[model samples]
Target: MNQDIELLAAYWTIAGDIYPMGPTEVSPFSFENRMEAAGQAGFKGIGLVHNGMMDTVDKIGYPAMTAILEKNGIKHVELEFLVDWYLSGERRRQSDKVRQELLEAAEALGARSIKIGPGIGQEIADVKLMAKEFRLLCQQAAEVGTNVVLEIMPFSNVRNIETALAIVERADQPNGGLLLDIWHLERGGIKFSEISKIPARFIKSIELNDAHKYAIEPLWMDTIHKRVLPGDGTFDVPAFIKAVQAAGYEGPWGLEVLSDTHRKLPLEQMANRAYESTISQFRK
Candidate 1:
């Protein structure tokens, strides 16, 4: 394994349930099994979603869960998918509860960051208001000793590098930054040149995935079910890697292939392939 790369087994890589779309009916791998496979496959980190984290802790104690990850040699942890923070009323309150739990879990698991994003849609919110909310979220996360990273998605409000960077700048919290995913960058039409311009400190993390040059129909469905392995698609992954390295991002790099087909593989096979495919990019 390349010590500099710190490959992460992203949540969707092994998650049994795909949500909204239902279960993938893949390998019925348990959390411990996933961690063990990841470690054996040379992954240094593993991502945990909010529901997964809660369920894992409930089924096994937090200490026991931590022990399993430690025994598997997992170092970095990532928790994700907080939404509705920009809304007011009951929706925001519900989201806040989930966010609080996620932040607490991140602190407990020593996760690098909690990924947050706006709901998927074309509607854009007031950047200032978004910044204000982001600032408060960062402060809250800071209290738990975790970072809050805003993810830019093609269908989300923060749909481009510029908008994501702007919100992070306005928030101005050291613990608040951007979670740049290669898929989103490509689908959102963000140039690698723009990514190179971001200051290192503002890029909290980077996730790698590949897809066709032209988007599949119903982009959201395709994103959830059709992402290819890092080197198997049309993405200029080597260039993306070089750009981030040039920008001075030294954080963990995650393999976030969210494909239904991928979820059906045996645990070890999935982990090994994900790690191998991702590291091949850095080698180039």
Candidate 2:
């Protein structure tokens, strides 16, 4: 089963020594090291955050980064977490700047997709406006020969499949789709059966991770510091995987563990555990 499926090491999973929301979000490890660890752990692809990508591109350039990826047998690269896309004023301007950088990186790296989402802890009053803005983003991504995948979070305005699907339906772009994370879906209280109802084309990607059945208070804390390996927590990882597969999702499964404990492990150990634990779910 592991041989048949490709696993992607999401940025947070192997992001060495980075504070997620702190002033500095760059990983201390070199890009080559991260790729090497993931590749050695049997991952076919890897993810990078915006700041990390910028730092690497500035330090060694895209050609060097590309060479390292080729050296590691990484076929798929996922770039992520673009927010403030649907807003206006200074925020929208800043969002546009980041969006351009991500698109450029995606085109240069031949990345599989760029992950985006609505703002966390904020709700948009108009879904149609969000759709309009998302359509533009998708069009830009398509021009670069990549797709834009939307991740739904409980803290975001579009928290459930129903709302997420509505936005994607309205956007109506083939490359504009949903990123269904097992942690988010389960934490948000969305049913596994809801995934069965989504059209395959709309299910662009999926993430794997597990957590306690009940989230800790101030949910964001739990997501960042309490996530466990795929089968280590109470999540029904197998069922979620089955639902996504049933919906015809054929892309790599993103392993996005963000626990404090996971981050403390040695690079090789973290990568190994992430790959081995998630792959075991498929065998089950």
Candidate 3:
């Protein structure tokens, strides 16, 4: 294994005994257990979903959470899924509430980044206004010493690398950047060569996962339930890893394997498989 290529187990990758897109989104496994499993699997970091993280923080407090992370050798923390950040009215109000919670947790835990995006299937009517809002959001995050990473999904309005690049470029904050997921990039038909066009500063984070050559109908369902581990499917994950590395992104690579089959595995197995498979791609 290349010790230099550290992996951050994305929330869903090791979220054992959870029904994704179901009524309950939080993991059944405790935070301490999650940290232990991730650490033992050789992960240097772990991503946490907002609701689950808030519940854990409320129960144990940020200090306790940080202690667990430190004890388990988890260095990088990613707090995520803040959507509706670019909208107005009641939607924006609700988003602000979640944003406040996520930002506070981020600052308290010294998290590396907070992920955000406009909701899937909700098209942006005013790209300029959205860019302005993203800039402001990034400014607020920068105040707390973290970066705000926007995930570009095929189901979302900022659906491709080009449109996502434009928003980040316009947002213009050093802490504002994009989250490039291999599943999204390949499923959305984005070429690997496009990775070169993005400046190093704009590539805030990268996620590694694989899938069948063809996407299932209603693409979101395919991503949520069918994603395979890196190198387990048709995606050229090794090439993708090299592309990102060549693009100058040195941050921890995220292993975001979201699948129903994966969620049913033992926590240790889930974490280990995710780490081993992703790290193997680097060796290629």
Global Cα lDDT for candidate 3: 0.90
Deviation in Å, model 1, residue 43 alpha carbon: 0.6
RMSD values for the candidates in order, in angstroms, are 1.9, 1.0, 1.2
Q: Each model's TM-score, in the order given?
A: 0.95, 0.98, 0.97
Model 3 — which ten-residue stretch has the worst lDDT?
117-126
Q: How many clashes in each structure?
A: 0, 0, 0
Task: Score each candidate by Cα lDDT.
Answer: 0.85, 0.90, 0.90
Task: Put down candidate 2 lDDT per residue, 1-284, tens digits, no spaces.
Answer: 66889999999999865556866778877889999999999999899889889999999999999999999999999998799998899998998999999999999999999999777998653689989999999999999999999998998888988888899999999999999998888888899999987899999888999997778989889888889999999999999898888889899999999887888888999999999999999987
Q: Which residue pairs in model 3 clash with each other? A: none
Task: Order the candidates by lDDT, highest first.
Answer: 2, 3, 1
The regions of model 3 sitting more than 4 angstroms off are none
CA lDDT of 110 in candidate 3?
Answer: 96
- Give per-residue CA lDDT, model 3, range 134-181, as digits (tens): 999999999899999999887888887778888889889999999999
Candidate 2, number of clashes: 0
